[model samples]
Target: MADTALPGTRVKVPFAGQAVDGFVLARIAESEHPGRLQPLRRAVSAEPVLAPEIAELVGDVAARYAGTRSDVLRLAVPARHATTEKADSVPAGTVPPPDLAAWSTYEGSAALAGLAAGESPRLVWTVGPGDDGIELLADAAVATASAGRGALVCLPDVRDVARLDKALVQRLGKGRHVVLTADAGPAKRYAAFLAVARGAVRIVIGTRAAAFAPVHDLGLVAIWDDGDDLYAEPRAPYPHTREVLLLRAQRAETAVLLAAHARSVEAEYLVRSAWATSVALPRDEVRRRAAVSVTGDSDLDLARDPRARSSRLPKEVFEVLREALTVGPVLVQTPRAGYATRLACESCRTPASCPACHGPLRIGAAQAPPSCTWCGTVATGWSCPECGGRGLRAPVLGDRRTAEELGRAFPSIPVQTSSAERIIDRVRARPGIVVATPGAEPPAEGGYAAVVLLDTWLLLARSDLRAEEEALRRWLNAAALVGSTADRPGRVVAVGDPARGSLQALVRWDPAGFAQREIAERQEAHLPPASRVATLTGPAELLEGALAVLQLPAGAEVLGPVEVGDGSEEQRYVVRVPRTAGAQLSAALVALQASRSARKEQHLRVDVDPVTLG
Candidate 1:
């Protein structure tokens, strides 16, 4: 035992062709094993890569996510770099912290003020639509820094990180903070890691991976837009940003803040349970920031107005766009990117597919011919398999087609398109229309004069659990680009069913109320955010065997043994348990995973609290 290294320490061990770097899990006594074990080649790091508390956190996450220690460790620590060994000194700073009074103006921000003053407080706050997330985050960081402790703020993607970093550096000074993201050059990423590990930076801000950075004397951990799918890691043993921060807050006894314009059901769950205080603006403030309205197409006058319902620009929407464009650039939010993303046969009403490859047909632009989305073959000779129909119709329109329609309706007006392939971060200060897909909307120079959210039905039609919530988020995010306030008020027009809960919420400018309703509905339905759910995927036999052996917590239910993936192999099942029994459910799954690993059984992937149930 004396000859072996302790857990959390780095060591070199024999591998496929040569010695490879590894972490020592435990000390094994020579007497315990009769076989002659390979000696440790050498120690890799002078310091423990996993601190005692962080090591404990790794195990906790493994149990919670049904993941292995190594999976969590992959994000906890970065690969070793020689350049990071140089000693980095803490830079001096003394910028005036953000006005605490400004933050306290929100309905329940007093608790957050306490958090900045070194008191442990947990809060779920929603800034009104169009409010800058970076501003709130900077305020929290400044307060934490003033109290002489570090703060960690995580955003969903690099674009968000860039926005927050610019604000943090201006408020906290360049040297007092460090930026961490997966996109950073190896040396730059490791340098930031060294800064945090060495206690040289008090403010750590980055994307998903930054949630696990080893900061010293952590006083606050904050996450922005917890609902974004970008926060959910795509790799094995996926750990969501919101859950990770929650765990860290509990383990470190630090202040926690989950802020977003459109709150998630899970965040609202915390508020309901009284685990966190709710911070939000009053109704008047919300109305002041976001003056939203619904323009439904169901109106008889609207119904009688156009020949092409799918691409026709509503007269009301056109008037709004005309007015908005006269003042500044207007934004048109579309759900898809291509010209006509979905096609169907006019004769039979069946979905149109390419005859050559049976793939879905799409048009690149209004003038382009129908082509297969999968095989990229032009469907010039294609016929509908269902009715031998020669003509195809577009059931759902897209951004390019919408832009083309708008450009024709308002001739002499410049038009631009932004989507997956081409992304313009900022639109120029011109009286024109910038058509964009969701999440690809560009920032207008001074703020958009108005935003028209087109085709709202497409987003709400998704089968996922978060369809409505996500749709409102996308709409509000774009609407937020319009300047808000009494003096320079901005407007947003949603083209859809006005009776829908989400649309009504947007019109009333009440995201929190909407979220509360959503949470209540989920509770009634026994769905996630109200309950705990886990998904298991593997070979059919292995899945069944493991399911039969699992000691599920009381009241746990298994939903499916549904087939997934190619018919050659693979299937999936979902398990649900009451929120009160979440720990028990995870523990049982962890035990099953460990057993499978021990027996060298065929692999199965288990994910607890997955972002999507389907």
Candidate 2:
């Protein structure tokens, strides 16, 4: 036996009823029953998959999320493909970073300049919504690389990664950087991982998993659009990418840059606590780059009309689109992607449901029969149960339907649709209608001539705690696509009440101020960003037992053992604690999990700062 075997030693061992690849912990130099120990099957790799820093990160994440160490490790170090094991090493190269000095003249650039000089500057940067953010992010990475240190930039998804990848390759040249994302498949992804792990690449850009990428000589960690839901890991433990980077910064004492079009309450908390500095452009500069406006039905005189509120494109929006189309393409942002998401009865104004299954009905086309969204059953002869109405109405419209409507409205022009399954990256400068759902809007070459944000009420009426905050983010992201005054004068018209804070924020183009107000509201309401919250899901008896032993901090507020599922058989409970005791709460939960494991109790699902309590 090797006396000096240590952690991160790759080995094969028994796992889940088979011999699977694993890693070594340490040597049992003085084990009480050394003879009884099973021999390590074999070594899997010649090098460690995770560096010491990443390994420590896995431990911290596991403890914080109350998740099993194995699960966190699984995400940290994905499975390697055999084909990449023999890949050749990458040669070094360098390119001068773009002029970031001009950015230093902006409000928050000094801290960033300090970071570029190899000082650890933790700052939250707010940039107006647009593709301009791509340049800002690439510049930050370039500065880090120029400082002779490796940098990791994490975006929300593969699409964002591709966009930033182009910008980086343009700024930093080719061999100096690598991108890590699952979309590239196992072999290519693993190849990139190995390249970074072997110190062949000094800059790495990727999605959520890249937050843990073992870049050599790490100096900076940057995350773009930190508020995107895609950054919220879906697997057990559900560690958010933003928090992971923050922890990495604290542990490694590296510079941290969090850039977003709209501020997240968590980011606001960091700034308020003085843990991170705030970076923003001057108000005039922002307005010069982005011209945003807020409009409502009243502005279009539709509020006086009894049936005008339900019209997808009110007269005002139609007029705006008509005028904007002459200049360039117009973008219409819808909430969902379908023909008709929600159907209703024309006579009674009642929701239409399928007779066969009594499920909510939706229409795939204007002439299509009502179909149940749940059971997929077509209701050819459906009647409104309340009013016996035969005619159907669309209460909520989706992108496909909006595109179809706009197509008919402007028969001479083209209408394009972008969404989750079918995403278009860029649209050439032309006179047309681009109908897209949130986050799926394609970038216009010269930027959209104008934008109409529809159904603001519907977007904000979600049960999630960050619903309003996220609505504004999506709106800003779409609006920011409008051209600057130099390229094409931009204009935006939102279809909602202008008095609302989110809409007002959009009008004023002030996300930071909006975030500050949101923080205050959350504090008053005792919601996240103000106070820590944890949700527990399990069998009722098991949860009861677990809560009985949970040593919560002082003044902890327990919410409910809310009933879930179909009127039977399942429930989930929520517990809240003061934000100051968040760490203590996590510690207590970790201890409880260990206790449960020791007694072999049934597992319980634990999530902190969950996006939704319902």
lDDT of 2 by residue, 1-614 (tens): 25323466578777556787667655545877747666666677666676788888988998777787788988888687777877776756654656786566469788787756777788888876444687788888888888788889999888889999999878766777888886778988888888888888888999998888988889999999888989888988999999889888899988999888788888988999999999987887776776676555554555454444666566677778898888888899999899899999999889898787788999887788778999999888888789787998888988889998899999999999999979988998889989999999898987888889999999889987788899999998899888755654478889887778899999888888899999998889888878888898888998898899999999798888888766666678888888888988888888998899888888888998776677
lDDT of 2 at 268: 82
The per-prediction tally of clashing pairs is 0, 0
Q: What is the lDDT of candidate 2?
A: 0.83
Candidate 1 local lDDT, 118-197, one digit each (tens): 88789988876656766778888888878888889999878778878887777765787888999898888988887787
TM-score of 2: 0.93
- What's the TM-score of every candidate structure? 0.92, 0.93
Q: Looking at candidate 1, what is the lDDT of residue 69?
A: 84
